[model samples]
Target: MDSERDELLHTFVAEAHEILDEIERALLQLETGRDVYDVLQRVFRATHTLKGSAGSVGLGGLSDLGHAAEDVIEALCRGDLPLTTPVVSLLLETVDAARRLVAEVERGQVERSTSHQEVIARLQEARRGGPAEPQGAWATSARRATEDDAEGATSIKSIRVAVEKLDRMADLIGELTLGRNRIVRTLRAVRGEAGAALRDEMEEQDRLCRELEEAVRAARMVPVGPWFRHYERTVRDLAHAHGRLARLVVVHGDVEVDTAVVERFRDALTHLLRNAICHGIEAPEARRAAGKDPCGTITLHAAHERGGIALRISDDGAGMRRERIAARVRALGRHPAPDALPDHELFGLVFEPGFSTATESSHLAGRGMGMDVVRRRVESIQGTIRIESREGHGTSLLIQLPLTLATIEGLSVGIGDERYVIPLRAVLACCDLPRGSLAHGGAQGLMVRRGRALPCVRLRALFGLGGSPPPDERVVIVALDGFEAGLVVDSLDGEGRTVVKPLGQLFRRVPGISGSTILGDGSVAMILDVDALLGGVVRDAVPADALDERRSAPSAAGGSPG
Candidate 1:
């Protein structure tokens, strides 16, 4: 009985948080003066349901507070109160309070941690004394029938599965994939009639496994829209606090991605967006002086691209200045003349450790911002991030991420005796580069491909594998974002469908390797981190993760194929 009751509380907490997200979004919408009547109604229904749900679960304090907040919204709906900035702000604050209460519930605590007396008292006062405003469309919409808010009714085609259960299922599928690989490998040796029959049966089984893998991946996916919508409040508050008018425009966020990926990037994107608001945006007077709109704009866009997801965050504010960056670089005593590096590489320096243009620190952001952390997170998921900035125009960051981290389509290649999987999407073309044609002293080497010189690195030399290379070396030309590079290997071993698995602690810290995958022959191969591989070639010069060694650089493989 206690187990069932605990489960109910968990469900309630989850539902409450989602409702609070909706309420917070509605409050932001209210601030914009759009569909006041309908917005209030939706929030009213949500709040009423929350109050009733809390009461049913014996959280009286939360229920009472919700009642007070409900009274104020009800007043606004009836034209007894106005839909002004104060009301919306107060309601948003109330939403925060409710979030805290729900958190306590999530912690398996029946006892409330907060009375929220101050917020509740102010809400009641607003309900009683706030002056009525012109009815407008509110009065007419208020007359329309709305079902009792206390009732929780829903029609949905879904089942609630614990996240752990889903993860376990995914793990099992991964194991099954490994087994399938082993069996398929064995079948390749057979050549008689019985072997042909076994091959046909194996094909059927492979089809089933692919379908199951896709189903599981689909189950783990969540739409990026709701997650993206939550940031509207963040942008609004940040802009207001800084005394600027900034709008967050989210486009095509309806694209779905792995739920884990969504949660992982939450803080990374927040740090990026916060920087956009605080530092990237220009104040109203300055904007007018620059002959631009007083209100700056921030755009968050997501879409499917190149067999993966591409997310771009851009701002119409004073873009980064190359001169200022160069000056800062010189001040830091960097050996490279800033002019020697290309514009892209120069802009990337801003992500280096302790790199910031802010003159002072604030409670929100300053000194040691998480741009490096952001890059690590992106690269950890086998994704790539690139920065684009224009003087006095704007700056944009584009990030590319694979759809599901559990599996990958990769080109299996050989360096000496070792096999490494280069992400298939990263591959542009594969060709031969003779060993005698290259001259190199440092780790950085250059190769001419398609009549253009591009940075090239030898895998065996880079990873320190002990073996003599083939005279005719092959190069898998890959691109991440706009930067292109070449990885020289002994041979191209064709394409593969590999299931990603974690590596031990030793390999996890390795810079160039991302994760490991088991081949049909049961030999483990390292998955190369194309972005990290380019880290040296790109000449981060000073990496943001140089000091701390980003723990989130994903997994690494140990021991080469014998």
Candidate 2:
């Protein structure tokens, strides 16, 4: 009986949090002054349901808070109260309070507290059309929803599985993938020794294994709609607090991706949005002075691209200034000439620790911390972030991430004794790079490909594998976020349907390597970060001779394969 009751409590907590998320989003919509009536109705209904569920579970304190919040919305619906900023803000605060109560329920603790009483009192005041009284609960209720709840409701189409269980399932799928690769590789070598029947059975098993892996991956997929909606209130409140009129516009919210990928990107997305609002968007007066609309627009767009997902956060605000960043860079005493650096390098400084141009700190930004964290988080998921700005026009951040972290179709290539997997989406083609075709030295190298100068990175040299290059080295051309590069490899193995497992923390900071996958022979192969490597090659300077060689090769079929 106790076990059943505990299960019921868990369900209630999960449902309550979902309702609270809706309430918060509704409050944000109300702030926008669009669909006010519908939003208010939705908020009221969610709170009413939350009240009933909490009461049913004997979580009286949580129920009371919900009841108070619902009353305020009901008052608004009945024309007893106005939808003033204070009213909406108070309701938003109540949502925060309810979130805390639900968290307490999740932790199996008593929900009632002094802070809950204070929130109830303020909510009552707000409902009565009086100014919501400043209460002691304000400090305690000031909780930011930093992370997402892992639990989601079960439906007829789906069963509720614990997140840990899903994680374990993914791990098992990865191991299965590794084992299957081993079997296939071994079978291929001994095809003549094995009978036709045995070969056919192994082939059938491999097919089933692939199908099962895909099914598991699909099961872990989640739509970005709910996740995207959760940030509406955050942008609204933070924009208002900073006295900036800004709106968050989310597009293509139905894009599906791995739940783990979404969770991994949570903090990074939040930080980037916050940075856009705090630094990219300017005050109303400043915007007007720049001959732009007083109100700013921040867009969160997600879509499927190249078998992966692309998320873009853009703002029509005073775009970032390269000069200002260079000035900040100089203030840190880093180089002989800061302004002489290229725009990409200047922008790259934003992700460096203690890199900021803000003159002062605020509730939302400053302290130069968010961007660095954003960069680190994106890389952790084997993703890439690209920033584009037009000075007075605006700024756009494009982040490309895999749809699922579990498995990817990659081009497995060899570099001497080591192997690496390059994402198939990024791979353009493979070709032989004749000796001496690679121009320039040091960190920068270039080759000519079909009349265009292409940057190249030698994997053996990059990873310090320290071996003689093969007589016939191959180069795999890869394209990421409009940038193109060629990765010089020892040999081109065939296509790989590889499962990606994250490397340990000790290797987390290693450049150009994202994760590791177990190869067919039970050896681990590193997954290359083509985006980062290309960016690094761009950052380095190519010698004049290399440029001449690249220019001269345009008539020689440009060094690309036919």
RMSD of each: 9.0, 4.9
TM for candidate 1 is 0.80
Per-candidate TM-score against the hidden true structure = 0.80, 0.81
lDDT of the structure predicted as candidate 2: 0.75
Evaluated with TM-score, which candidate comes out highest?
A: 2
Across residues 1-562, which tens digit of lDDT does each residue of candidate 2 receive?
A: 3898899998887787678777776787786678888888998888899999989988888888888888888889988888887777788777767777776766777564558888798888777667774543222222243233223212211336655576677778778766776776666766464555667887798788778878777788888877776666666656766668777888998889987787788878888877887888899999999998787889989999978999989999989888788888888976668787667667777888888888898656788899999988997676888788889888999888989888888888998888899888778788888557664223347766677777677777777788678678788987654556678888988886787888899997787888888766677899887767766643344455664564445432222222
For residue 201, model 2's alpha carbon misses the true position, in angstroms, by: 2.8
The per-prediction tally of clashing pairs is: 0, 0
Note the Cα lDDT for every prediction shown. 0.74, 0.75
- List, residue by residue over 297-377, the lDDT tens digit for candidate 1: 899899999778999999999998988889888888763698676788888787787877778876555776578878878
* Candidate with best lDDT: 2
Candidate 1: RMSD over Cα atoms? 9.0
Error of 2 at 390 (Å): 3.6
